[model samples]
Target: MSPDGLCAHRFRHTAITRLLRARVPLRSVQRYAGHSDPQTTLSYAQAFDADEAIADVEKLDY
Candidate 1:
């Protein structure tokens, strides 16, 4: 992909991720992102949730 395409993709990704992280409802973010499938929006939410979950788990004491 071209550099411009990559930048645009990152912008989309970041926007969706930030919205999900902000506790915006999934359906609202999906509509704002123009995602045809709810799963597409869920994927971004899952990725962010998984990353935070891993980080929190790592801080656990034995």
Candidate 2:
């Protein structure tokens, strides 16, 4: 369990989503995820679905 008592996977997704939300750069996420290149980590970001893109669009606040 996480510190917040949520599933550990939730934290994983949160981390990736947080990085995406911060516009931290996919290449940076790649390095952070210890991926050979940005592509691998990119797959993780899309592993669940296109939620990151959806979240970003929802944040438009328009």
Candidate 3:
């Protein structure tokens, strides 16, 4: 039970993010997630950007 209550969408979001982070192909994730629009699945890419950006900054030699 989430503090915000049980919302199915939150689970969907978490699954999407996990799959993406695990390097699952976007098309495969779309099919697995049952999203009719590829664009909708692509939207999850933004969620990973912040983490990736942080990792990039950490890798800076300076």
What digit string (tens of lDDT, one per residue) describes model 3 on residues 26-55?
A: 667878989886667767777567665355
Cα deviation of 46 in candidate 2 (Å)?
Answer: 4.2
Q: Write the per-residue lDDT of candidate 1 for residues 6-47, one digit (tens) a residue.
A: 757778888998987887766678789998766667677665
Looking at candidate 3, what is the lDDT of residue 44? 77
Off by over 4 Å in 2: 1-6, 44-62
> How high is each candidate's TM-score?
0.62, 0.47, 0.62
The number of the candidate with the highest lDDT is 3
**Candidate 3: misplaced stretches above 4 Å?**
1-6, 49-62
- Candidate 1 vs candidate 3, lDDT winner: 3
Identify the superior model by lDDT, candidate 1 or candidate 2: 1
Clashing pairs in 2: none
| Model 3 vs. true fold: TM | 0.62
Please report the TM-score between candidate 2 and the true structure: 0.47
Query: Which residue pairs show collisions in model 3?
Result: none
Off by over 4 Å in 1: 1-6, 48-62
